[model samples]
Target: MSGIRDAAAILAERLHAFRSLGDNCEFGFVQRYGGVEPSGLLRFSYTPLEDLIRGLRCGFSDFGVPGDLRLSVSAGGTYYCHSVAYNIWANTGHSAGSIAPEALLEREYGRLAHLKGKFLEDLADGTKILVRKTGRDDPESDFARLAEAVWAHGPSTLLRVTEAGPGWVPEPARRVADRLIAGTVRRFAPAEQAWEVDLEPWMHLVDGAYALARGAAPARLDADAFPEVLPLPGRLRRHVGRHREPALSAYTRAVDPAAVRGDAVHVFSSWVWIPEDFAGTRIFAAAGYARLGWRDADLSRRGCWQRVWAAGRLRPEAAREPVGLGMIGTRRDAFWSVGARFAEGPIPGEGPAPALRMPPARFPGRDLLGRLVPRFA
Candidate 1:
């Protein structure tokens, strides 16, 4: 709220599609109206926290999906938003799962770390790459080399199978990696083989650890895997949705909303249904932005909030009675101020501003993967 103009300017650039008000408009811009016929809305302020509360309360009770919304203001007029919601699209895989040895190897996304060249640079920071070589996976490949290394090392020397790229790694470098792997417990993406190595007492990789070797394996480890998820981009530890993770996968924690001097904003495109069980429970989640609905009123609660529009030829002013329907206009000069002061003159009919539309995700940064740039609307 302190640097109102600056904030609007920054947000406006991110939201280039929105029709801008006059250069001197005090408040924010207009909102999206999902309807035919000449219908529109002009938003005085972006109520992020209020919207989140409404999203969760209504979402849990009706939709069974509890969303997170935070809107609070400070004396300095600083406002921020933290929105969380189940990624409807991403929840299916983990809803029910089975983890076998083949599953573990399939998700050995840790192998992505061993990559180099332009391929590595092109990938997102956290993308998991598979170990199986698509280029040329031969019998005398990295896997065979690893088996020999393990047998040669015996019990004294440690055996780790990290390889930079395809093919067999040099023995000297391989030995060095083994030394580092000996004492550490971190799950290194060992060079993979074409076939599975089934031992009589199958050694399970549970939660990135060799379960059978480390004392007695936890009873839960026998299952091989469980519902797991990773925090989305920009979110500290909020899961987009429950997803199947390897038995040796890392755990994802919840990120609490921290006080901020600046504002992180987003908008919900529909009246989200939330259950009652989610009361006072906060979580983080993020994913993709997809349109659920169109109407702004449907997105908010029932009668608690109302969409207000200006009633004038030009951009309408506050304090002035909601007289005419607000659609399009020239600049601020065509409207009146709350203090009963006329801006300039009966400004000429300029035109309608560009229409503002819904973003892809309902709750970004908090409930799903954070969006860096504004796309459609």
Candidate 2:
């Protein structure tokens, strides 16, 4: 446990030296394990943190992880992750295409277009100040006054009530909304009254819109917020793609050895910069794996005209040995490589990585919202 903590501290220091801590870059450092399943095929696991570190250090005596292993560190530039989550939630499903009055006001005032960067900066710094209103009177007028106050404050974002009328938002819906607002907005005070806004146990339709153009809305807008679209700090879309696409393929088994429970795979970690839509420095660190089996052993069967589908297919007879291609180590070293060498002989000592993939990176962005609504689609 101390070793892992020390490792984390070292990683933090390195990132700090690299200036990767701020500048809106998401950072992650994790270790992945590969297990030589009972079938002699390799399977990689996502177990993250202490358990993963423990397994790796112990030669995985508990489960028998063998073959090859590597430690991973990564960082990526991103839009404010809270905004990204709100945007994704707003643009998908029922919330899609639904415009907010606050959004209209923002364009009219040009707050987001001109002040987005500053707003994000404040939000990230936890220096954002929200002036709440009782909303006992007209919500429209209250929203207008709130907007003016925010404008006077200069370069801050807005949080408004999504629904109008007398009834409070339903408890579950209110919980979601409060979670989004309180999570996004860091601090707040009363606009017209002396009382402080209820944030910790927040249950209001009002919420912040730091990334309004990126689909800003309070949680009450849609209670069924996609689990994938929750606030996560410095979480760029590219990292998510790596997890869903390539990393996922490693575990799902693009090709599987028949009758074997779990085996026939090779894994490694890679470091590369993920491209950003806007011009800015970015970082990407990841561990990826590939299956080591004949194309004929592909788990998914191709129907008639398989040859047409799989053009340039290698004959199973010609491709006699199973070879899974993978690369491991830091950007500098190919500490390990699989493909030709793995087919020839067994690599010693590293054992297998582990039985689980690293868990998703945790940061302050999701906080309460992640707990309130655990199910994400």
Candidate 3:
């Protein structure tokens, strides 16, 4: 169990690190035959999971494994809840005949107990956290039997109900199940928080990160993009205007527009750190951008901000030029401005997870990155 604690801590640390980078990082893992492979800092703008799936299939094919492989994968980043580490065991080999879906559902029934005994029961007191369990269970499966079981444990955030198998019911029936579970769970769990979902893994709920992964750089706004402009504080004005630099300039540096590729750009107010090397004509856009107070919120909230800002699209040619971009910071108090480079185009919805393009060379692919990275989607 201490190993579980250590692994959970590692997962927590990885999640915390990924979140701390603002919105400029990606993380993912691929599991084959119970062995987890760390998909190295995925470079997709939004489809790490999709790419990971392709990579997994490709890797399996390369290994010449037979039969239908069981796949249990989770992929998403930044814009997601911080999930503790969990494993999805999958096998590759000859089929062992069909198994009853109900019997398969039974396998999930003990998951919560397994989690509680090994980890939750010993967690430090007053550690605010949330736990969710998802599988293919329906009303006929008697999922309500475990209501008391879940209620016995803690995590007071919300309740999620997922019915994925053949016995899935309509919205009304699902709601009834949700109501029954919410009504029975004797805790601060709210009725509104009881959510019913599709057959996909619960980790799929964090698709926002994957969806926004690819897209046109928001900083590339057209001339007519600015329809609204608000007043700015004097301190903020000098910062974006480059009239003064932040005291902690030592820790931050200016970004080069020419160097921007598929990376995401974030704006910050000059009061905290001066944005250098911006196009001269767009200096006013900096002050205008400062209306968003994301930097301030980041200071207080620590890890809450994760959504991509829908600023404006730049022309393909504009990718080489710097542009002043602004967004309503996560805090919503004031906007922030920065001269950034957004080379990636916008992706609608899940779009396509980028293709897995391992260089054409013979090497130990699995050994290099084969460590299970906790999916905190």
Error of 2 at 237 (Å): 45
| TM-score, model 1 to reference | 0.16
Q: Which candidate model has the greater TM-score, 1 or 3?
A: 3
Candidate 2 has a TM-score of 0.17
State model 1's lDDT: 0.21
Q: Which lDDT tens digits does candidate 2 get at residues 81-198?
A: 1122111001011131244534433332342223334433443443332323222344455344434433443444333333233233323222223212322222222322212222
Q: Show the lowest summed lDDT stretch of 10 residues, model 1.
A: 337-346
How accurate locally, in lDDT, is each candidate?
0.21, 0.22, 0.23
Candidate 1 per-residue lDDT, tens place, 86-204, comes to 11110111111244433433332222112212222222221111111111223344334433332332322222322233233212211233322211211222212101111101111
Instruction: Give the number of colliding residue pairs in candidate 1.
Output: 33
Q: Report how far off residue 64 is in candidate 1 (Å).
A: 57
Q: Best candidate, lDDT-wise?
A: 3
Count of clashes, each model: 33, 22, 19
Q: Who wins the TM-score comparison?
A: 3
Reference-based TM-score of each model? 0.16, 0.17, 0.20
